[model samples]
Target: MTETAEQAVQFVAMARKSFPALSSMRGSGGPAAAAVRSAAPMASHFLRRRGEDLLMKAVQVETEAGLANVREIAKVEGLDMVFFAPVELAASAPRGQEAGLLLALETAEAEVKRAKKLLGGMLVPGRSAEMMFAAGYDLVCTTSDVILVRAAAENIVREAKPPATGPKGGLVRFVTSGREAKFARNDETLVTRLKKSRQARALGALVRLGSAAAAELVAASGFEVVVLDHSRGAEDLLGAVALVHAASRAGAHSLMRVPALSQAHLRRALQVGVEGIILPGVESAEEAHALVELCLYPSRNLRDDSHAAEARLKNQPFRRMDFSFAPPLVEFYGQRVAEFSRRQGEALLIAAQVDSPEGAAHIREIVKVEGIDMIFVDAMRLSGADVERIETAAKKHHRLLGGLLVPGCHVEDMYRAGYKLVCAASDHGLLAEGAKACLKAERPVE
Candidate 1:
């Protein structure tokens, strides 16, 4: 059996084995026979992604501990910038310099808005910068900034000591059990959108998660996407699974940038409830076609004949998929996987990363591959002409285009350049940027 065929036998064995204790008991809604103060009147509006409206969070005062508190805020993990807001000048145009105030405000506001319109990577854990990137970026009127600063001020104190006892405890309790990531807590996966609106492009902020806390934080930060950066390989499979659970519970969509395209990696990525996979380093049309087959099972309306592939996969032996789990559990998982793969194209986002000219040269063929929903290109690679050629091909084939939110580029610029998806820098980059901002914010103003 080929690797994919061999692994197919384990599909049903791949049903996530976690979180059955409480999950097996579905809530038909109430906490009991009575309505309580803790219950809301409506279903939660939390979604797989946030809307297109721009968001800005401002840090007004760190009055708790003076410069020490200020420095504390600066060191937060993903905090990106310490924008020097010249409130005195932007607000108080002295009688003689009223006209000049307009110029000062324009220059200051422009300088204050951070670069790249971060994809919700603004606040990690540190205080290097007073403010973190929220979502959309635009010119805020002086009055609006002041109002926004005040609104965000409440969160500075509130998030300082958020409710600690909920999902964090849930992580410890269920993370080891291998919970099913799809339809977590009864919240539908983003895959449902395939059935509803295939033409709706993926838009809005995406935060890469490294921990359960990060997952909750990203979701609460209002980002629509919670991403796991598995480009380092599958060394952290358990950790990635935990993030998926946390992201699902916290109400965000999870996707992964995988290191390779092996059947084991792709199968596990899906079984774990990742909504999408961005596979890196593709150089040929055959590789792209293989990616589709490995990812999309055998859809008759889509890629290949489903019945034959199913039979081949079912009869194959895949020790890789059925390692040390109990026999009964493995049997159950295989069944679930078989069921999932049949309809996975509706939920899974398959992307190909074309970084070299070899891949770019085959852009038309790659974009024509049936199962891929998106194609990601490394902006730092390829000449401008190559990028444009890929862009044209991708659009012509009706594929969504994605790219790096590289420095010297804004999120809007990527959108204008015909990219529907734009990824920001990694958490490491955000952390380092935040750390620098902390130092800059702490320096005594001259």
Candidate 2:
């Protein structure tokens, strides 16, 4: 046999030696004597009489049938088996099977205990690693290929992206004393600033260009706000957090357009501390109210002090500052929850899109909804008359009018039409256009 295989066999033999055969247990004294007596039944569950050869094998399972087979083998041998059932397998198993397999493993674990045999459960990396450890298994398996690859990828991404530093969230105009310092920006928060600044005409950037580097570069380019566009592209919570932090560290305000009006997406965006959320395709006052409720909380109508928001703080990237949000082994997360809650729509901008005819039709009612701060018209989708109606409604309700202004749409016309926060071009649009221009320049026409 190869050296590694020889070592594995030697190790298995050593393990087997610890539990003496049932016939010899009476002679083995001390703690082991008692252990052997209790563990003898376990030996029978694993070993089978195959003429002259004995097989020592471990069960590595991801399915119910596989686990059941191991359980049956252990039962037949009367010696407990040290089975390896990875947590990832249990989690990815069919919905009901995931729970069922875990329970079955737990049941097999109990049988092992009864027979005084060995049972060690293996677990993969994820939120479940801690859960399985806390479940009181005898041996906790180390990281496997899944975890190694995940960790490696995360490390590479972190290395490629710049770490967040300095002040985070909102704008800060620092003032200094002889030894100490304090400062303030506009009394209006980012949302309020965008809402009330009619003549501000602050240059803003639409950050559809993903990656932490892109976000950081855009934030440093002197934009008043970085609107993270997820409506047209793919974005995850972690990426959004990175963008938000990068924007904040670069002294720019952060906003996000969620994939949709999803509670999970809204909560994650809020927890990551986006200064605003632009809800797309809002059609009615009721939908506006619901969106607003999801955006704001501690209000009379809606609240979510759930762990979903608080748990994001558990990760370092989502922490409020350099200091930890979670206290050392304490259950009181109220303070942390309150910290997240304070960033709600009232404190941040709650803008909605009047993109379709249905949405434009209810502009007046939608604008009147409490907590709705900005009404953005999708210039591409809405007609000139429709844009006019939305603009009129926004003006009447004293809400900010904002939208995406394409090439043909005059920026001055948008401003004249009372659109305060206008995105003339997005990161993707700029890059695509620049590439096309470069190609045309390279092959000049005669």
- Displacement of residue 26 (Cα, Å) in model 1 is 52
RMSD of candidate 2 to the truth, in angstroms, is: 17.2
314-341, model 2: which lDDT tens digit per residue? 4422132211122110111223433434
lDDT digits (tens) for residues 18-67 of candidate 1: 21322133553456412432464332222101211222322332111211
Give per-model TM-scores: 0.50, 0.52
Q: What lDDT does the true structure give each of the candidates?
A: 0.51, 0.61
RMSD values, in order shown: 29.8, 17.2
The worst-scoring run of ten residues by lDDT in candidate 2 lies at: 322-331
- Residue 147 in model 1: lDDT: 38
lDDT of 1 at 71: 38
Candidate 2 yields a Cα-based lDDT of: 0.61
